[model samples]
Target: MSSFFAAIFLLGLCLANAIDFTTVYEWNKFDFVRPSGVDTSNGQIGQHFHQDQVYFQYMAVFGERLFLSLDSYSGIPATLVWLPTSGSSTVPPKLAPFPSWNLHMKDNCDTIQAAKGMEIDTDGRLWVLDQGSSKCSSKLWIFDLLNNDTTELVHQFPDSVVSHRYFKRELRDMVLDKTPEDYLAYITDSFSDKIVVYSRKMDKSWTVTTPGRKWNSLALSPDGEATQLYLARYFSNELYSVSVSELKNEGGRAAVKLVGEWFNIPCRMLIDSANVLYAAFKYQSYLSKWKNISEPFRDQRFYEVERLDAEQPFTFALDTNGTLWLTERNATGSEKRHKIIKAAVGARSYLFKPSTAMTAPQAYVSGGETSDDMKITQTPTVIVISLLVCCLFLCGSCQCVVNLVRMRRKQTSLRQISKDNREQRSALVPVNL
Candidate 1:
């Protein structure tokens, strides 16, 4: 019985060790050719002819399509292309030139020089963050993806927002708030440690800078009641939060409070619909998450989900279905190591429930559980069954022992009765018979 219980425990431990992390897409190189008969004199013809010079920096997902943006910091033309998630054997088709002008045109509002960060809002509009280049000015481009094959540029940030200061700013990542009453956009400037807030309705912008907080990444809280902005610094692993109302006030610098130290240095982070915060560690090649946003960072649960090599330009995107897609940035002048990896973290509906307070997901590292979530709440069903079987076996063994004792006593009593009967018969018969 003890051996049976030991076997059951071993089986349970083996079952807990199984987890799957899958790689969905990989490529040895990225190549794109200019369409036939395109004019070469304008210089737009050679834009994508030299595919070896291009490298991927950022990515965003909309529906079944994945959008990639090139780094172009080294004189390559910044490019954007979308391909089906079903994996393609060839280079993705480039989005057509903006309707008003050709790609070769200088200072064109339609072109993207360097896109470091982009996000898809709830309204299905894709907001692109262009850091600008020698030819282009720093600007925000909004496109309606639901429109024709050529994504139409619906709106552009005004010159007032993209001023001289913007040119000096190194915009990293952005989050959109499409609330009916307040349409706000929060952008982080890693170089200057500033947060830029823009209002769509008023068409005005404001900048907020803190003395100690050096902003690197920003994520909006999933809670709809309080508008909170969570941001991290360039090299610091600490997380901080501030209210949007305070940040928008032009009166003074908003009060920024430290949420807690994340311990792992984070490069980028995103908040899911469940209000869970997922952060990609800088050069650590692993993704970790905080299950609860409202709770204090120390009290909240953290789990590490995926692990990869220490590669430059690591980035990730979360899809509508709660799947995380990640890849390392391709480096210029280096052998291509292009790959897109994805992990299905179950659907949002299954993972999130409004009634129940969401707890952190369980994760194992090197075959050992890492967080408090791994604590066993109740005995497993298999272990319970094994215990019941052992109890039944013990009961049967006790019953057999009782029966054997009863039989031994019965035989001894019968022997005594036979001796008494023989003695009495001998007395009834003649004395010495």
Candidate 2:
């Protein structure tokens, strides 16, 4: 009987190991690496030589150095950091071969503001997603690195879109949907939980709108064949995907498809050449239940790695090592500490156990993959095979239990013998200290 329990326990652990797990490496406070040089102004490790400002925001690894859109929320000058990578956890105490430049978005702007997302276009032009508001900047600044000018405003969106009340307003982050030609860009309006697609050339005109939220982010594939957008909707703790097809339509509307939820509160999403999607979120929810701030970080915080398991997940550039890169909105430390999260595997679990709270059958459904087909395919034969495996697990568990029981009995008997011997010895001995 005990042996059966032991066998089952062993089998359960083995089965759990069958699934591949992902490891997440995090550098909370630029702990990974540091840039060298002292700005005579503030004397901080990495400061804009021209001025002292806090350079913090989303990062993009281009060459050996990581480029950050220096987002100083308090009207501090916005700049870009080109820090060298030392191949170590801690960054080398030096700047990149070239000095970190404060590519201040000047002209047509009254004050300085923080930038959100960024991208390098097909022609190698730098596209910066500036917050379209007095809150930030009311335009998406495209710096033509080749021309060496920041005064040019490649595209500008109205401030009203970035504000509340519009369908697909601009919050901060922007992505290029450079597919099928003339499809243009997909920008995330975090305030409205919507993604606004715009034309690349001719003033960056608006194209289409999709779902998204504050902490949401996106990326484009290197193949230039598709676009993979990641939305981290905090209210419902849902992660969503919007696709930009390489295929075209007659009306010039890129046949856009909402691929459904990808993960919970996904702060950022990246896709590699192998089609692996790496998602970074504020919190990781394992179930349908909502989570709060007090949740354990080990259980719910940090980023996760997931494979693009569907026919068409999001798209992105594939590096030499086959890694994907993504762009995201401003990830402030406060949000990282307090924001909520959702689960990537929530859809499948919901299908097995229909939630009474769910109003429709479609609630358990996912994008691209339908639950009905999965349900029908899971027949009696599959269940029988599962049962057989479970039985083997039980056998292993029972063996462990039996060993435990025998060991316990042996311990008890030995203690009893020792007690009897002590009693006899005490009777023969005189009282002593």
Each candidate structure's TM-score, on Cα atoms with residue i matched to residue i, is 0.68, 0.48
Please list the C-alpha lDDT of all candidates, in the order they appear: 0.61, 0.41
Best by TM-score: 1
Give lDDT for model 1: 0.61
lDDT of 1 at 213: 70
Per-residue alpha-carbon lDDT of model 1 for 288-386, expressed as tens digits? 677668775642323333343444456777776656666654443456555665544432321123333233332212212222232232236745665
**Alpha-carbon shift of residue 174 in model 2 (angstroms):** 2.7
lDDT value, candidate 2, whole model? 0.41
